[model samples]
Target: MYQYTPFDRQFVHARAAQFRDQLERNLAGTLGDDEFRALRLQNGWYIQRHAPMLRVAVPYGELNSAQLRAMADIARKHDRGYTHFTTRQNVQYNWIPLPQAADVMDKLAAVDMHGIQTSGNCIRNITSDALAGVAADEAIDPRPYCEIMRQWSTLHPEFAHLPRKFKIAVSGATEDRAATGWHDIGLVLRKNEAGEIGFQVRVGGGMGRTPIIGSVISEFVPWQQILVFIEAVVRVYNRYGRRDNAYKARIKILVKAEGQKFFDAVAVEFKNILERDLDGSAHLITQAEFDRVNACFVRPAGVVAQPEVAAAADLPLAYRRWLERNVHAHQVAGYRAVTLSVKRAGQAPGDVTDAQMDQAADLADVYSCGELRVTHDQNLLLPWVKAADLPALYEAAKAAGYATPNIGLLTDMIACPGGDFCALANARSIPVAAEITERFDDLDEVFDLGDIDLHISGCINSCGHHHSGHIGVLGVDKDGTEWYQLTLAGSDGSNHAPTAVTGKVIGPSFAASEVVDAIEAILDVYRAERTAGEKFIDAVKRLGLEPFKAAANARRTATARHSDTAEA
Candidate 1:
């Protein structure tokens, strides 16, 4: 984890103080609500459906025990007793009062955390693979580069207000765990034949009312010029991206409309930045600055390679299952990355209670070198777990209800806080997610069914990343009733599906009561149609959506007939 420097701490504190002044004036009838709207949004405060929501940035998903504890305290004292971890590697509080917003900011700053640039049509948090540094397949650690971009984008005068919200993700591993293809700007670090480090730049990928996979703009951009190249990309978007309509303001829209023309414009801008501007080369990352940032990402003091040990054949079946699902390989021998399952029965996916946060912090201190990482899949990861401590850690995690062995199973779905908390939600997402989770509570059945990415969103904003799910459920409003639209064959560009693409909608939306049954019917079709060992997504692609669509719609038809019979 990158340690905060003196300047970093000072800047965070100053920003908190500035927000405090603005908040006080707003409450005192001096600054109007309209005037304070942008100010509050810039600082990560939103007047949500019920109360003020604060989105605290967790840059690249890195966190220390101290920061985790601070957040736990805020969840306990200030608002609800839990926090929601988002797919973008950020945390949100849905019940914080507007007046106490400044106080919350102060507490966050005390631990080197804040909501800066977390909201409001600007460059959002710079996210990367949760297993960036430790993944066995990594080509280069991306944390240092992510931190560099974080510093550059925060409060950037040139990009404070773009046509719409923008996001960027980076992945250095051979596998795209960060879902780079779904970001406004996706960066994949690689080394050329000359062993020179550079990035594969993909721009214009996003999910919303319009979901598009990013196009590869540059095959290889030298690492030193990443900032300058990105500047050119955003500069072009800011100049031409749609501002008249909020729905079409994302760079994805511009990229989709212009296609090759958009890429050409960006290339021209990159050349202009490097050659036409007086300080063209000023933004180039110097060796010294890179070294300074890179040094902070080194292995923690006490963590080192240990003698490899074999797993005991006598281990409990449940424990073995947990190990297989939740533990991941690390680059360092004898070390593994362990995921704490926040998605389980009876809870919304990614919702962590205050007590659980504290427990997680304690686990970090004891088992993971006091460090943690938030994964893009809406789970917490102990990135430095010793292989020797697996048993003890598993036991502790089980006791805390975080040891469910369903990491990639259907039960481990991603869902946003829909109508329950979000004002923009067309329907409630929690109930749908809860129903699906309850229907798939049997681990044996889940494991047999194999890995599935089930994502649910309250609306088209795609906050829950429904567009990337193998089985996607999106909430839609039909007249005044809540309904769900199902899609199949979507992917997040992981090993499961090497290409990132939005799921294709099956057919008409189903009533809320029929969603769970519809999902069950669709899975039933998959089971009957799939070949031996075929994953759900592969089956969907091979068999097409027609079979599953027919099954789901049949369930809807049956339900409607049953209702008619009852009315008769």
Candidate 2:
């Protein structure tokens, strides 16, 4: 994890103080709500359906034990006793009071954390693979580059007030775990034939009311010029991206509308930026600066390669299952990356209570070099777990309710704080997520189902990344009644599905009560039709959506008939 430098600390503290003044002015009626909206949004404060929400940025999903503890304290003292982890790898407090928002920001700054650029039409939190440094298949560690981008994007004067929110994701691994193809700017760290580090840049992918996969703008941009190239891209969008209509304001819409014209314009802009000697090389990332950032990402002091240990056949069944599902292979010998599942019955997916957060921090201190990574799938990752400590960690995690042993299983779904907290949400996502989790509680059945990305969103905003799920459920409203639309065969560009594509809707929307049954019906089709050893997503692709669609509609029809009978 990158340690905050003296300047970084000063900047965050100063920003927090500034926010306090702005908030006070708003409260005293000196600043109207309209005038203060942008100010508060830049600092990650939002007036949601029921209360003020604050989203704390976890840049590239990196966090230290102290930061986690600070967030836990805030949860305990300011907001509700829990916080929600978002798909973007940020943290949100749904019930924080507006008056105390400034105080929360101050506390966050004390721990080298804050909510800067977490909302508003700016570059949001930069995300990367949770297993970035330790992944066995990595081409180059992306953490350093992610940090570089983070520093460049944070409070950037030129790009702060874009037409719409922009997102960027970086992936260096052979597999696309970071969903780079779905970001507004997706960067894949790679080396050319000469073995020099650079990036494969994809631009304009996003999800909302419109879902579009990013187009490959440049196959390779030298690592040193990444910042400049990205600047050109954003600059082009800033000049031409629609601002009059919020719905069509995303870079994706601009890219889609312009196509080759957009790509050509960006190319010209990139050339001009260099030709004009803009900033006189100030924006260029020199090797010294790269080295400085890269040094922070090196293996923590106590972490080193260890001798391999043989697997024991006598391991407990539960522990073995947990290892199978939650433990990921590490690049270093005799180490593993373990996921602590926050998705379980009763609670919403990604919701971690204060006690749970504190416990996670303690687990990080004891087992992971006092560092934790928030996963894109709304889970916490211990990235430096020793293979030898698997049993002990499993026991501790189980006791802490973080050992659900369902990493990619159906229950380990991603869901946003829906109508329950988000005013923009058309329906509640929590109940839908909870129902599906309860329906799939049987581990045996879940494992047999195998590696399903079940993502739910309360609306079209895609905060929960529903468009990327193999089984996507989108909450909709029908004449004031809550309904859900199901989609099949969406891919987040993971190893399972290398191409990022939006899921196709199965059929007409289902009533909220029929959603779980609809999901069950879809999976039933998979189980019946899939070939041996095929994953749910692969099965969906092999057999077209017709079978799943028919099965889901059948369930919906049966539910309607039953309701009609009861009414009669």
Candidate 3:
């Protein structure tokens, strides 16, 4: 994890104080609600359905034990005794009051965290692969670049109020766990045949009412000029992006409207900007700066890998299941990245209690070099877990309610805090997620179902990244009744061409009560048609939607008949 510099500390503290002052002015009647609303939102405060929600940034999904403890404290003291992690790798406190919000910001600053740039129409938190440094198949660790982008975009004056919110993501791993293809700007660390490091820059990707896979704007931009290319891209979008309508404000929509002209425009701007660097303004990046950031992320000393032990053979079946599901391969030998599942039965996905948070921090300190990472799938990761310590850590995690042996199975789902918390939501997402999780409670059956990414969003906003899931479920309202629409073959940016696939709608919407049944029907088709090693996404892609559609509609018809007979 990157340690906060003295200047970084000062910057965060000053920003907190500034917000506190604005809060006071608003309470004093000097600032009206209309003006204060924007200011508060810029500071990551949202007026939710029940109360104000404050989102705190977990930069690049990295957290130290001290920071995690601070977050737990915030969850306990100011709001509810739990927090909700989002798809952007940030956490939200849902029950915060308006007056206590600034105090919350100040408390966060105490632990070197803040809410700035987590919301509002500006560049948001820069997400990277949770296994950035640990993953074995990565071209380079992307945390340094993510940190650089964070420093560059945080409270950038020119970009404070864009037409709409913008998001950027970077992934170094071959597997696109970071879902970079669904971001406004997606950077994949790539090395060319000449062995030169650079970025494969993709632009105009997003999901909402309109889902788009980012187009590769630049084949390769050298490491030194990466920032220059980003600046050019954002400048072009800011200058020509639609501001008249919020619906068409996203860069994806602008790119769609302009077609190839958009790419050409960006190319021309990039060339002109680089060509006119008389004072070398465009070349802000340097080898020295890269080295400085890289140094902050180097592995700690006195932590060499140990030889494998035979004691693993004596572990119980439950412990073994957890080990196989949650523990991931690492770049270093004899070490693994352990994902602490927050999606236990009866609990909403991604919701972590304060006590669980404290326990996670303790486990990180005891077994993971005191560092943790947050995954985009809304789970906590201890990125430096020693292989030999797995048994003991598993026990501690189980006692703390973090050891749920369903990492990538049907029960391990991603969901947004929907009508339960958000004013923008059309229906409740948590209850649906809970129902689906309960339906798939049998671990053996879930494991038999195989790797599935089930995602749920309350509305078309796609905050749950419903478009990126292998089984995407979007909550919709039809004539005041809550319904869910299903889509198949959605991806988390792991396709062959470095792009994402927006899952196609499967069939007609189903009632909220029938969501689980609908999913079961779809899964039934999958289980019947899939080959030995076919993943859910691969099976769906190969078999098409007709078979699944037939199964789902058949179930719907049966349910309708049962209802009519009961009425008679």
Stretches of candidate 3 off by over 4 Å are 310-314, 495-499
Per-residue CA lDDT of model 3 for 1-568, tens digit only, reads 7888999999999999999999999999999999999898888998889898899999889999999999899889988899988888899999988999888999999999999988899999999998999997877999998898899888888888888899999998889988988999999999999999899999999999999999898889998888888888888899999999999999999988897898888889889988999988774679999899889998866567768666546778888888789999888888889999988876788999899899999999999989999999899999888888898899999899899889888888999988888899888899999888777878889988878988999999999889888888999999988999999888887532234889889888989878888899999998889999888788887998899988888998888899899999
lDDT values, one for every candidate: 0.93, 0.92, 0.88
lDDT of 1 by residue, 429-494 (tens): 999998888888888889989989999999998998899999998999988799989988999999
RMSD after Cα superposition, model 3: 1.5
| Residue-level error in angstroms, candidate 3, position 267 | 1.5
Residue-wise C-alpha lDDT for candidate 2, range 1-568, written one tens digit per residue: 7989999999999999999999999999999999999999999998998889999999889899999999999999998899999989899999988999999999999999989999999989999999999999998999999999999999899999999999999999999999999999999999999999899999999988899999999999999999999999999999999999999999999999999999999999999888888558547899999999999988999788899898898988888899899999999999999999998777898999999999999999999989899999999999999999988898899999999888988898999988888999999999998888778889999999989998999999988888999989898988888999999899899977888989999889988889999999999999998898999998888889999999999998999999999999
Prediction 3 global C-alpha lDDT: 0.88
Off by over 4 Å in 1: 277-281
Better of 1 and 3 by lDDT: 1
Task: Estimate the overall C-alpha local distance difference test score of candidate 1.
Answer: 0.93
Residue 336 local lDDT, model 2: 96
Lowest lDDT 10-residue stretch of candidate 2: 275-284
